[model samples]
Target: MTDETSARIAPPLTDLPIAVSERGFYSGFSKHVTIPSKIIISLLIVWAIAFPVNAGEVLGIANTTIIRLFSGWYVWLVGGFLVLSIILAALPASGKLRLGRAGDVPEFSRFSWFAMMFGAGLGIGMLTYSTGEPLSHLQNNPVIIAGEATALTENAVRSAYVYSFLHWGFSAWAIYALVGLAIGYVAYRRGLPLTIRSGLAPLLGHRLSGMSGHAVDIVAVVATILGISVTLGLGVEQFVQGLNRIGMGDWLLAKDNSASIPAIVLALMIIVGASTLSALSGVGKGIKWLSNLNLVLSFILFAAFLIAGSALFSLEIFARGLLDYVTALPALSFITNAPDGTTIGDGIAQWQLDWTVFYWAWWIAFAPFVGMFIARVSKGRTVREYILGVVIAPALMCFVWLSLVGGTAVELVLSGAGEGNIVGTVLSDQLYATIAALMDSGLAYAFSVLVVLLLLTYVITSADSAILVVNTINAGGNDSDHGRRHIMFWGVAIALVVGSLLLVGGLDAIRTAMIIGALPFSFVSALLAVAVVKAIWRDTIRLRHGIECTVPPEAKADPAS
Candidate 1:
C-alpha cells in the first residue's frame, strides 16, 4: 500500500486535548500536582482514631458475596486473553508496532531502570508475603489443586512460588503494557494531557473533552486513590508489625488497630511528606533515586536470606520451585475457589476465595494507575523495549525474590531445622521474627533492619507516584499543577481511608474493602475490551491512510460531544 493508503488505515486521535501540557507532565502522562503538608499529615490522626477497621463487616455481607462470585472460568478467560496479547507483543515483527517518535531509546541504564520499576511495582507484595505467607502455604498448599484435603509434602514450596509468579507475571504485566501503550501513544504522539482519560481519547474522540469525560476522569481518580492508598496502608501496617517483631514494641505506634490515633497520624505524616518532597524533586531524580535505593535494599534482603537463613535449602528450593512453577503455571494461573472448587474444610474454601479473589482484585484495581505510571516513565521508548522491560524483566526479578526469601522459609520449616512457628506470628511482628529466626548474627539483624527501612522507602516511592497519578485524573487537562497544596489533599485523604479501615479490621478489613471498591471497576475493565479494540481499529486505519488533519480548536481538549 502507498504511504497515503497506509496512513489512511490508521485511526484519528480520539479526544486528545491539543498542545500537551509540557510544564507539568512527567515521564509521559503523569503530571506534578500538589497536596498540602498539614492536610497530608492529618491522615495519621484519623487512622489513629479509627483504631482498627472492621473490614469484613464494613464491606458488608452483600459486597463480600459479590466478590466471591468471580469464578475460575472468569480468571481462565482473563488469563488466556492476557497470554494471547503477550504472544502478540513478543512476536519478532512487533518492532513494527511503534507508538510515537519512532526509535525512542531508553535514556537510563538497563539494570538501574528495571530494578527501580520492579521495586516500585512489586514492593508491597514482596515484603507482605516474605515471612508468614510461605510458611502458611507450606503447612497446607491449595487443597483444590492438589486433590487432597491438605498440602502434599513436596508441593508446599512449589505452590508458593507458583502462586507468586502467577500473580506477578503476564496477566498483571499485560494490564500495565496495554494501558501504558494507550497513554503513551496519545500523550507522546497526539500530545494530550498526561491523564488517565487521555488513554481513552482515541476511542471517545472529542467528546472526552467535555463533562461526559469528566465523569470518566472522576472514576479513574477515585479508583487510583483507593487502589494505591490501600496498598500504602498495608505497607505502613507491615512497618509497625516489623518494628514489633524486632523487639521494639513501643507504644503501638506501628500497630494499626493497636496504634492510637496519634500513631496513625504520625505514619500518614511520614508517608505524605516524603511523597510531596519526592513529587517536588521531579520524577527522574526523586522517584528514580528512591527506586534505586529500594532495588539495592531488596537485593540485600535476598542475599541475606540466601546466605544467612538456609543457604542450601534456599538454593534447592529456588531451583526446584522454578521448575515446578514452570510446570504448573498454566493450571495455577486460572484456578478458582468456587465449590466443586475443592472439598477441603469449612473455612478452607472461604480462605481460598478470599486469598485468590483478593489478589486478582488488587492487581486489577491497581492496573490502571500502575499502567499509567509505566506509560509515563516509558516515553521515547519502543514497543519491543517497553514490552520486554515492563513485562519480562519484572517477572524474573519477582521470581528471584520469592525463591530467596519465602523459599528459604519453606526449606527451614520443612527440613525441621528451624523454629517453624515463627512464621505463624508474622501478624504480630514480621521483621523481628524473620531476622531473629533466620540468623543469629548482629550483622544479619542490622541487615534486616536496613531492609525494613528500605521497604519503607519503596512504600514512599509507590505511594507518592500513586498520589500524582490520582491527582492527574482528578484535575483533568485544565490543570496539571493544581500545586503541592492540592496534591497533598488527596495524599491525606488516602491515609485516612486506609488507616481507618486498618484499625477497624486490619488486613482482613483492607481485603474486604479492596474487594468492595474493586467490584464496580471490574466492569470498567470489561469496558476496556470494547474501548481498546475500537481504538486499535480506528487508529490502524488512520495510520494506513496517512491522514494528517487538525482537530477542532476548542473541541480538541473538550471533544466528548
Candidate 2:
C-alpha cells in the first residue's frame, strides 16, 4: 500500500510541460494558452463591435449550419455522458475512489460546497429561465403541437415541465459531472495539474503535454469565455428589465423594449467590475459569500412566490412534473426530430433546435468552467458523493424552482389573474409581470427589487467563478494567487465579449457564438468520458494487484512506521 509500490505498479502519470512566464504582468501564466486565447477572443470582440451586422450575419449562418449538422450529436452525446456518469458511480469499486490523497479532507463545508456548485452551475439560468421557459413551453411544445394536450391546460403543464426538466435536469449536470470527475481524478489522484488537457492524459498519455494539450486547453478557454459571455448577456438583459420594472422607466430599454446598448454597457461595467474584485478575493471569501447571499435571496424570492402566488397549484405541478419528468426522461434524452416537411414534424424539429439543442450546446460550452469550479471545490469527496452532489442535488433544486416559480406564472395565466400580461410579455419581462400578477403594486415593486438584488449576486458569482476558471486554465492549473493581472485581464475580456455581442444582436448573437464555440469542446467532452473510464478501469486492475490507487507518489510515509 506504499506510494512507491503503487507507483511501480501503475502507469506513469506525467506532468504537463506547459511553459509559464516567470516575470512581468503575465508572470506565472502559460504563454501557450493565455496568448492564443486572448488573441482569438479579442479579435472576436473587435469584429463584433466594428462590423455589427456582418458579425451577426456570420454568427447566425455558422450557428444554423452547426446546429443543423450536429443537433443529434449534441443530444446523444450528452445522454451518453449521463449514462456514463451513472455507471461510474454505480460501480462499487469506482464509486469508492476518492478524488484526493488518502489523508486529504474536503476543503469546504457541505453547505458551502453545494452553494458554490449550484451558484456557479445554474444560478443565473434559474433566474432567467425558471419562469420564462415553462411558460413558453406551456404555450407550445411537441406535446401541444402533436395534439396530445391543449395549451395552458393541466396536461400541457406536465408537458412543459417534462421539457423544462429535460433541459435543467440530470443530463445537463451529467455533462458537468463527467468533466469534473475526469479532471478531479487525474489532478487529485494522479498528481496532474488541474486543467482540461490533464483530464485527457489518461487516454492521450504524454502526447497531451505538447501542442495537442495546449490546443485542448485553448479550446476550453474559448468555450468557457463564450459560455460565460452568453450567461452574462442573458443576466444583464434580465437585470435591465428588473430595473425598468422597479421604476427605471423605458429609458433603460431600446425602442424594441430589449435592453439598450447603453444599459448593457452600464450593467456590464458594474457587474464585471464587481466580478473582477471578487475574483481577486478568490473563491474562499468573495465568491463564497456572494453565493451564500444568492441562496438566501433566492429562498426569500421563492417564499414570496409560495405565499403570495399559487402555492397549492405549484405544489401539484411540482409533484406531477417530477413524475412526468422521470417517466419521459429516456425519450426526452435520446430522441431527436428532423423536419419531414410536415407541420408537426417541422414544429418538433424546430422546437428541438430552439430549446433542447440550444440547451445542450449551452451546457457543453459551460462544462469547462463549471466543471473545473466543481472539481476545484470537490477535492476530497468520493465519486458517488460527487455525482450525487453535482448531478442529483442541484437538479432537484432546479425542478423545484421551475415548478414553483414557473408554475405560478402558468396558474396566473390560466386563472386570468395576469390579464394576458404574463404570457404576452417578453422573456425578460415575464418574471416581473408574474410578480405583478401575484401581489399588489407596492409588494410587487418591493419584490422586484429583491429579485434584482438576487440577479446581481448571481451574475457576479457566475462571472467571477468563470474568470477564475479561465485563469486557472491559462495558468496551466496553477491555482495560485500569482495571476491577479491575468484575472483582471479575463474579467475585462469577458465584459467586452458580452458587451459587443449584446450591442450587435442581443442575446441571439451570443447564443449563436456559444453554440459554435461549444462544438469543438463537445468532442473534447466525449474524450473526457473515455479517459475517465480508461483510468478507472486501469486503476481497478491495479487495485486487484494490491496496489494503492488513491495516494500519489509524493505523499510522505508515516514517521512512526
Candidate 3:
C-alpha cells in the first residue's frame, strides 16, 4: 500500500510510518522503514560475520585504530554528559515536568518499578563484578599503583571501592537516564514514534522522518545488539564457571579448558533457550516474574555476604567510599590522563583506556536498550523522580553491594584467609572461582546454585527486554505484541553473535565490538541530551505562560489522515 493509503487505515495504537505487515513473520513488524536502516542492518550482519571470521587481523586493526582512538574522548564525553544530567535534574523548572499526562500516575508499584529497572540495568554484571572488581582494584588501581607501600592497605582497599562506585554509579546510569528522558518526553509528550529517532524529533522536527532519522535508529539497533551480546557473553562465561566449579569441572576441563568454546556454547544454549521462552511469554508474565525473583535471590546472596563477613567494616567502607566517590567526582569525571612516559598521568591514562574508557563505551552501548526500557516502564513519573530513581537508587545499591561483597573478599585475601589468587581469577574472567574460594564447601555449593539461578534470571530479564526493545525499533516504534517469530529471532541472533565472538577472540573481541558500536551512538546520545534540554526549556516556557503542556487525547493521534 502507498504511504497515504496505509496511513488512512493504520491503527492509532501505532505511529509506524507504514501499516503493520499482516503477511510477515511478525504481526506488528513494519513493512516500511527508511532504506538507510535496511542497508545499515545488512552491513552490520556482514561485518559481524567477517570480523569474527578474521578476528586476528580485523580485531587487531580495529583495536589499534578505531577503538583506541575513541577510548580517550569517550571517558570525558560520557562523564561530562552524566554531570549534565544531574544539573538538568536539579533545575527547579525541569524537575517538576511529568513524563506523561498531568493526571497520569505510575503504572507499576514503587517496588516493582525499582525491581525491574535494577534487574534490567545491572543484571549479571553486578554478580560478576561485585566481588571481582574490588579485589582487582585492590591489587592495582591508579591510586595504589602510584607508590602505595602495601597492596592491601586501608588506603588501597578504600580506593578500590571508590573506583567501583565510580564505574557503577551516577555516571553510568546518567547515560541511560538522559536517553530515557529524551525518548520518553519526545515520544509520549510530543506524540511521536517511540524510537531513538523520536528522541531527536524535538531538535529535527519532521526532518527526523528522513535518512538522518533512519541512521539514528540503525545505530541504536546495532549498539543495542552488540551491548546485550557483550553482557550475554559475560554472563555465559560466569555461568559456566559457576557450573563447572559445582559439578562439571572435569568434563569442561577435559575438552580444552574450563572456559572452552564448547563450554561457552553449552552455556549459551541453556541461557538463550530459557531467555527465548521468557521473551515469548511476554513482558507482564515472564520478564516481570523473573526480575522480581532475581531481586529476591540477589538480596539473599548479598545479605549472606554482609552477615557472614565484616559487617561493621563493610558499612565503614561503604560510607567512606561514598564520600570519596563524591569528593573525587570532579577529577574522575574529566581527567583524560595523557601519556608522558613514566609518570602518574601516563599510568592513569593507560588505566582509563583499560577500565574507565571501556566502561563508558559499554554503558553508552547499553544506554539505548536500558534507556528505552526505562522509558517504557516509567510512563507517568516526573523528570526528577525518574532521574533520581535511575541515577541515585541503583548507584546506592551498587555501593552497598560492592562494599559488602567486595570488602569482605578483600579482607579475607589481605588477611591471608584464602589461598586462591582472587586477583588472578578475576583478571582471567573466572570470578565465580573467587566466590567459591570465599565460602565453605557446603556454603560454596549453595552459593554456586544461587548464582546460577540469578545468572539465568538476570540474563533472561536482559535478553527478553532487549528482544522487545529491538523489535520495537524494527517495527518503527510500535511496542504492541510482536509475533513470537520476531522475538525468537532476536534471541537466537544474540546467541549466535555472542558465540561467534567468543569463538573468535573471546572477551577481547566482544569488548571491541561493543566499543565500535558505541562510537556512533555516542553522537546520537549527545543529540538526545540537546533534544531533552530544548524540550524541557519549551515546556518550562509553556508552564510560565499559564498554558497546559500536556497533549489532549484527540491530539495524540489522528483518526483521519
**Best by the TM-score measure:** 2
Ranking by lDDT: 2, 3, 1
lDDT of 2 at 448: 95
RMSD of 2: 3.3
All candidates' lDDT scores?
0.61, 0.89, 0.78
| TM-score against truth, every candidate | 0.83, 0.96, 0.91
Candidate 1 residue-wise lDDT, 188-260, digit = tens: 6566666666777655667666655555555555556667766777677666655544556576554333555
Off by over 4 Å in 3: 1-23, 31-53, 253-258, 426-431, 553-561
Task: Give the 10-residue window scoring lowest on summed lDDT in candidate 2.
Answer: 552-561
Write candidate 2's Cα lDDT for 284-318 as tens digits.
99999999999989999998888887889889988
Which of the two candidates, 1 or 3, achieves a greater TM-score against the reference? 3
Q: Model 2 segments beyond 4 Å from truth?
A: 1-9, 551-561
* Candidate 3 residue 526 C-alpha distance from true site, Å: 0.4
Give the candidate number with the greatest lDDT: 2
Q: What C-alpha RMSD separates each model from the true structure?
A: 5.3, 3.3, 5.4
Q: Which stretches of candidate 1 lie over 4 Å from their true place?
A: 1-11, 18-58, 72-77, 92-95, 144-155, 245-247, 253-262, 335-337, 345-352, 477-482, 533-561
lDDT, candidate 1, at 273: 76
